[model samples]
Target chain A: MSRTRVLVVGAVLVIFFVAGGILIYVNGHQGGQNLTFNVTVTGATTMKPDTLPAHQNDTVTVNITSDTDGEVHLHEYDIAFDTRAGQMVSHTFKADKTCSCDIEWESTGHPLGTLVVSP
Target chain B: MTLAAQILLHGFGPRYDLPIATALYLYAAGGVVFISFVLVVLFAGDRVGPNATEYPRRAVSWLVPIARSPWPRIVGGTVGLIGFLTVVVAGFFGSTNAFYNPAEYVVWIYFWALMVILSGLLGNLWYLFSPWTAIYDALARVVRIEPVWKLPDVGVWPATAAYFSFACLELTTGMANRPAIVAIAAIVYTVITLAGMFLFGREEWLEHCEAFTILFGIVARFGPLETDRDEGGKISAVYVRPWGVGLLKPAPSGWDRVLFVILMLSTLAFDGISATPAWQDFTVALKGYWLPLGAFGLFAVRTFGLILLTVAFLLIFITFMEAVIYLGQRKVDLKATVSSFALTLVPIALVYNAAHNFSYVVVSSQYLIPLLNDPLQKGWHLWPAVASFTPNFALAQASTVWYADIVLIVLGHVIAVFLSHLRAGERFRTAQRALLSQYPMLLLMVLYTMTSLWILAQPITRES
Candidate 1:
């Protein structure tokens, strides 16, 4: 075979391999499920299981109970809601964007944890 | 927590991309890189392409008049000066909040991220509108400026040092988010640069000491534009060439040049690595031992990590260079071979940088839109329509970003492999020897590509 044919065949093989890989991987993550998490905020830190993981398009709800009056700010998504000292507050939204977002205490800007939405 | 610390704890913006899945994508990228190497060896074996001097270039003679006109320089220089002044003034007097401050957006996003991206894709605009160079040129007309002292024959080591420090400031200091700190740092840098230019001479200082000049110039090599010069060192023609072909021109080789290029890759890799959870945990664990140092502990730890990564990169690169030398069994000096081959790796760096900062360039740069009306944020709306402009956060979706990053990273490795094959063909002067010498480099490229993909797979940040 000529050099050009070899090069052309090599190029096609590469495209096929790369495209096949992505298609297969993406096919596995087709649907999303609703996920709810109850989080406790003590002072500036979040309780155990800090990172809340969800999938793309999943409706995620976080119930926050804090000892201090502040707001819970979910970055990237730009969603926030107020939380009173003794009352439970919940924020729910579709995990439309896939990113590892920082959930911070809105008043002090302290990081409470991460909200990872995998695609 | 201080607001600046809070704001900068994760990043300047809230646009962290989803990490690419490593299992399938990493292997796919590696396979592509390997296959590209095989294809190059099979097809391009032993034949050198036209060297830089002999590369085919069709001069656009009509552009000579436009290129020679003084209007471009005058307008470009004025704009540069205005931009520099605006950043300084706004940084010092603008709102304390980084999100509201245009200075933070201009410096970090526009200049740091966007400018580098443009320099790689287009030609280096920094060459045309570098504020410091413009300032020096303007000052030279008013006063009979002359170099007070001669610059020694140091070969870009100062630039390497300057670049290292600049990277540390961008990555480690955590002060970059503070507008006031950015202003102060910009002022300090300007002062140092002006003093260097005045004492050592403008061209000398810019070539040897200025970090961005050297950096943008290097990235511009892979761009499509080319300025051809006559034997008299005057621009004779302007032409456009294929991207990545300008790298085929034999550039001056030295250890310092090699390290500068290596740092281009290592610093970009370090940016991705530093944001990973493993790095965060390691720093936290080390903080206990450094408690006596107070707030300086984290800063010290980060600086140490940056230096460690740079050194580690240098050593790994040298080992590969040795492998090439041994495999080829050529009488070439290791240092020369290393230096020459270093330029071939630039495509990888450029693409990695583009991929890593894709979200910042697309999404974060939009913050400048609203700021255009009230740059200082005192309710002075220069453009009322812009005042209501909201950044489109979804412009860069996580899936889109992940796929773009993977494709760009793989493409960059392929380009690098092709360039190295050409370089080997030229250097070894025999097809068999050139093909043999490339095994180590091909392996190195595959490994580096995998590492790049792996970094993308890791979470952007996980606060242990």
Candidate 2:
């Protein structure tokens, strides 16, 4: 009985390991979707919609209009674009990395919002 | 400065782990519950009394002579001293910009994040290269140093207090990322440590009062390598055992020690929770109440939250310990059982630290490459190749980090359950009593496991 118990436990663990690996691989490699957002920096650093979401491997584009002259810097992916006061600027990049990365005002280092790319 | 340079200096900016998929989270949680049940089914009836504290250790006698030699100490001490001095000097005299300053990266990323993970995986390397001990040992060689005063018998409470203060510095004060503040804190800590050693003996102060010394020592128990001392208190032999087995050794018993262990877990969890949107909302809601104090209000709110979280952890753990004692129907001392069992929970802390900081460490430590080329920010091309190298953010992709986080969390709880069972066996004697006592412990592990995963899945946000 003890020997049988050991075998059963060992088998269960192996099954769990294999299944978990396959599930993670499949979940991670899902196809991407194109996403776009129009973010307005109305106050010195406040973003209209402070949080942007996208799927992993998605093509992400952001159109920005700011009240002040500063650059919008997206962290992790290291994408950046300059915005003049009252002028619209657009930047595009593939969200290949999955992270809830901060979008910040480059000069003041104030966080404007977050761009979350999920798997 | 360029926008890139500004982003680089903003080292304390929001770092959010890619939240794990809900499906994966559910799978991992179910796996934890199922694994605990399987552990009981397989090992529940095995009775091993006092021998439960015993695990196999193989001594490498060939390495003993080399390990005891002065060469390792000299090289390790010199490197440690250089690293410490670099942080202090760069912090004080170097560029105010943290991008070029090595102080912030060395302290926050390298020492706090990286070294902690290394100690958990590779034994107590910190013991070999701790700058404070290295400096003391070097000084002792030149001058005869002895204790002027005996340290009071406080049972690690001083270290606990020191650690709590350090945690506040890292998590609450927001000063760790500033070069001048980091320098001042280092100089002040250095004076306190050296003064303590001058009054009390070196070993006594380190063992009872020094925060990192106690912390790294606890974390190193999960590592595979261990040392055995001779009658004269020198390392006589080096042994290699299985990871997580060193925790089964008889733990030093005290309420202070228990609180220290709980603090380790609570502080780590709090760091993760503080970054979540929910915690951000909670803090923002309470901000109005303390609005009169201005800037200090945010700091006070965070510190209060940290203390409250710690107290909640302690209360919950104690209640669970009582449940275990009551259900076991054995005449066990609550204090003794609680203290011994507290060490078993450390695996969870270790993995949580590693999992939560996985991407942060990977991405942040890369800054060291460029910093190494021009650590003082004088624009000297000391190593041009390294200075021009770009950081590889793609190394920690969201899907990959999520899998790593879930696996680490699950593995940690499984180990915790195993350690708790062994501890219960030591206390309860009979296999049945031991198994019964662990029911409460198993529940606690499952609960903690879910909480860890839940924290990992929360959206990251800055504290208001």
Candidate 3:
């Protein structure tokens, strides 16, 4: 093959990866699954199951139980709830958008978890 | 299908939280961007844009007019040196909680992520604020001595290695989690920096060895204001260049610089990748395979993968560049083409970095508030009045993050396309040939753009 042809072919080769990525995107949509995630806050800085999967239209629920009295904020869904020691508080909403949002304890800047909502 | 294509598409599976919608749009928009770059290169002709307009002419006007005096240097440099020393000491002896230690926030969030973003936007403030440079300058001035040794002729290889090492330290290790390690790392880095400065003159060492110096300098090229010193050694006024126009003057040259450009992209690529579910899974899978080799084997395998990914980035870039050269019918030497066009990736790397670390910079940095209240985690309180201060992460909304992410990525990619077009125009004699030469490069940019966007949108999994 001519070098120009080879270069064109090589550029075309990249398209396969691009196409695969796009295919992944085009076929991927989230609005149907109902999911519940249990997030246990370990300390002032960490959380168990630090990430959870949700969809934009699904009834996604996050049940967070902490060892300390602090508020949990779900940033994308934009909700906050107060939690005392040893109680599992649940926040449920439409996943809204296929974007990731942080769930964190307000005071210590400790991440409670993340909600990876899909479209 | 290539192994990579299958891996990129299938590894995540349908259950994986890939940002399909975002990636799809990126693919389409990126194509449009590719065409736009082509048009700009072909028909737009030989316009070098506008000359840089100099600003207020009085940046150092407020500096108390201590021209060529050591007092200003001593005061500024000493404050920075004391701060660095304080962080090292605090790391060794302070609270074990990385969140409580000021060093974590100061180094990782403030210096690494936030300041990098600011430097890209507002120009090289970090060049002035660099702790090691300041300390070295003060020492050089006080000792009244020139550098004992000469600088190597190596083109930015030291900086590439330095930046890669810094990234590995941040990504592959838990330096932020461990204070003593942070202290040791800080000490080792300081020693190396000081020695290098002493050996190869302060300015030469910074330009060649300092990672942030190179990083902030590159990003500053895109910034509106630039500092220039004329032959008379007077403080030339800060000039406001047309957005990203300063990039046209100095493009990367030499093999080391080309590799530096590639490594710059790779390091950021690894940062984005390592944070994803896909990479976490890959590590988990590798852990099982490497378990027979024992505990250290796992670390060995992980490091191998890190190096492999970076090499893979190099391979992909050169392969594409080779194709571009072929398209241009070998008008430019391969190495020269690589150096000239590689600079176009700088803005993308900077923007991707900002997008990736947005949350960490915004929310995690909040821990600094309480840490500032008690830096040593002792009962010391410099600000007793602000003791009850609590950071609301909600202050940074999801829509806000999304806006910044998409906008910056798109803007940076467009700028990259423009930059490569401009550079190609400069390289190739004829504008038509230049436009034709960029077809492959533009395609490569689009591919990288989609990949970066997909990586950013990938769901954050638990760190393995």
Sort the predicted structures by TM-score, highest score first. Answer: 2, 1, 3
1 against 2, candidate with superior DockQ: 2
Scored against the true structure, residue B135 in model 1 reaches a CA lDDT of 87
- Candidate closest to the true structure, highest DockQ: 2
Summed over model 3, clashes come to 3
Q: What stretches of model 3 exceed 4 Å from their correct place?
A: A1-119, B1-79
- TM-score of each candidate? 0.92, 0.94, 0.75
Better of 2 and 3 by TM-score: 2
Model 2 per-residue lDDT tens digits across residues B1-464: 22222221123534646777788888988998999898887778774488776777899898788789988878877877887898899999887776667887788788888889998898887887788888899899999998999998998999999999888887777665678888898888889998998889999999999999999989999999988888998889999887888887776789999999999988888888887777877787887776677878766887888899999989999999998998777898888899988999999999988998898798867877877777788777788888777767775787778778877887788779878888888888888888888998899888888889888877665643
Candidate 3 structure quality by residue, lDDT tens digits, B90-136? 88888766656777666777777788888778777666577887876
- Pairs that collide in candidate 3 are A25-B20, A29-A119, A30-A119
**What is the Cα-based lDDT of residue B37 in candidate 1?**
53
Global lDDT of each candidate: 0.77, 0.82, 0.66
- Candidate 1 Cα lDDT to native: 0.77
Checking candidate 1 for backbone clashes, the offending pairs are B46-B431, B52-B249
Per-residue alpha-carbon lDDT of candidate 1 for residues B10-55, written as tens digits (9 for 90 to 100): 2355546777765556556766665665666464444642441244
